[model samples]
Target: MSKYIDKQTELKQAMIALRQERSQIYDELKEQVYHTSEYLRPSSILMRTLKDFNKEPEYKTTVITSVTSIIGGYLSKKFLFGKSSSAIKKILGIGIQVFTAKLIAGKMTHH
Candidate 1:
């Protein structure tokens, strides 16, 4: 009867230890989940994407091409049809703008 009591006590202590370990593991998993959620947020994802983009070797060229393209497109429109109110002229102006932008961007990228 005494040996039975000792074995029961040992088993109880082991269960308590196991419960503590399980609780600790659960807490760790919860913390990891929280961190993962934070990382996956939209703003966080955008920031990470921007950071990766900035690290690329072509980042400077890409930025310059985009800025130059927009400027070139706007200037083409302004120069070709400044303050024109004709529907045909407006459509042609938009087409020229897109063409100019694409041309400038393509030339810049090739260089």
Candidate 2:
């Protein structure tokens, strides 16, 4: 009976750890999906608009042109706003890379 109880306890602990790891992986995947969708959303919209225009050119030129202009404006803002958001993103990416490298170095030194 005592051996059975110990085995049960060990099984419970193993299940708990598995659950925790699964939860962490789920959260990370959700975050990645959200960020990826955000990055792709504008392009998706542009593609849909183009597809619609191709299907119905006669009915869509003016509307498509307007939407295209809007998309162009948005892309322009993304890359060429006065401060240039693209530049900022590049700088931020470099900063993150540097920070990550430093963190890895610190961890290695600690070991």
Candidate 3:
């Protein structure tokens, strides 16, 4: 009967230890979930992206190249088409603009 009592007491202690461990693990998981949610928020993501973009020189170069290409394309279209009212001429002008932009951007990248 005494041995039986000892075994029961040991089992109870083990159960208590297991419950404490489970609680600690649950709390840690909850904390991790909260942190992950904060990190994944849209504002957090946008801020991180902008920070990285500002820090990188390559992004600045890319932006400049893109803007210059677009302006060059616009100028070429205007110079060629003037103020034409023909739908066909307008469409052709747009095609020429795109071609000019691509060509300018490509040349800029190579040099």
Candidate 4:
């Protein structure tokens, strides 16, 4: 009867240690997730730049015109090439130009 009691006490202690270790691991994982989310939040620069662009009158018009031009160019290229690879190149070129223009405008206006 004494040996059985000793074995039960040992098992109880091991279970308690295992539960403590699990709790510690859970807390560590929670902390890591919190820190990671904080790091992923948008930077001040991006927010400020977006705010500045929103205040501009020409920004929206420029964006609209850029989009329209890309679409028009793509249609024209498709009509000209009739689904050839060259048409794809033209569409891609228009897309790249619009993207580059937006990036340049953003940088210029922000700075």
Top candidate (TM-score): 3
**What's the candidate order when arranged by decreasing TM-score?**
3, 1, 4, 2
lDDT per residue (tens digit) for residues 58-98 in model 3: 99889888999999999999999988899999999999999
Worst 10 residues of 1 by lDDT: 52-61
Q: Root-mean-square deviation of each candidate, in angstroms? A: 4.0, 22.3, 4.3, 8.7
Residue runs of model 1 more than 4 Å from their true location after superposition: 63-101
Instruction: Write the residue-wise lDDT of candidate 4 on 1-111 in tens digits.
Output: 999999999999999999999999999999999988776667755776678879997987677666665665555545545544576676766666566556655555564
Q: Candidate 2 overall Cα lDDT vs. reference?
A: 0.67
Better lDDT candidate (2, 4): 4
lDDT of 2 at 2: 100
Q: Rate the local accuracy (lDDT) of all candidates.
A: 0.95, 0.67, 0.96, 0.72
Pick out the ten consecutive residues of candidate 4 with the lowest summed lDDT: 76-85
**Backbone N/Cα/C clashes per model:** 0, 0, 0, 0
Runs with alpha carbons beyond 4 Å of true place in candidate 3: 67-94, 103-111
Q: Local error of candidate 4 at 96, Å?
A: 14
Off by over 4 Å in 4: 44-111
lDDT of 1 by residue, 1-111 (tens): 999999999999999999999999999999999999999999999999889888996887898899999999999999989989999999999999999999999999888
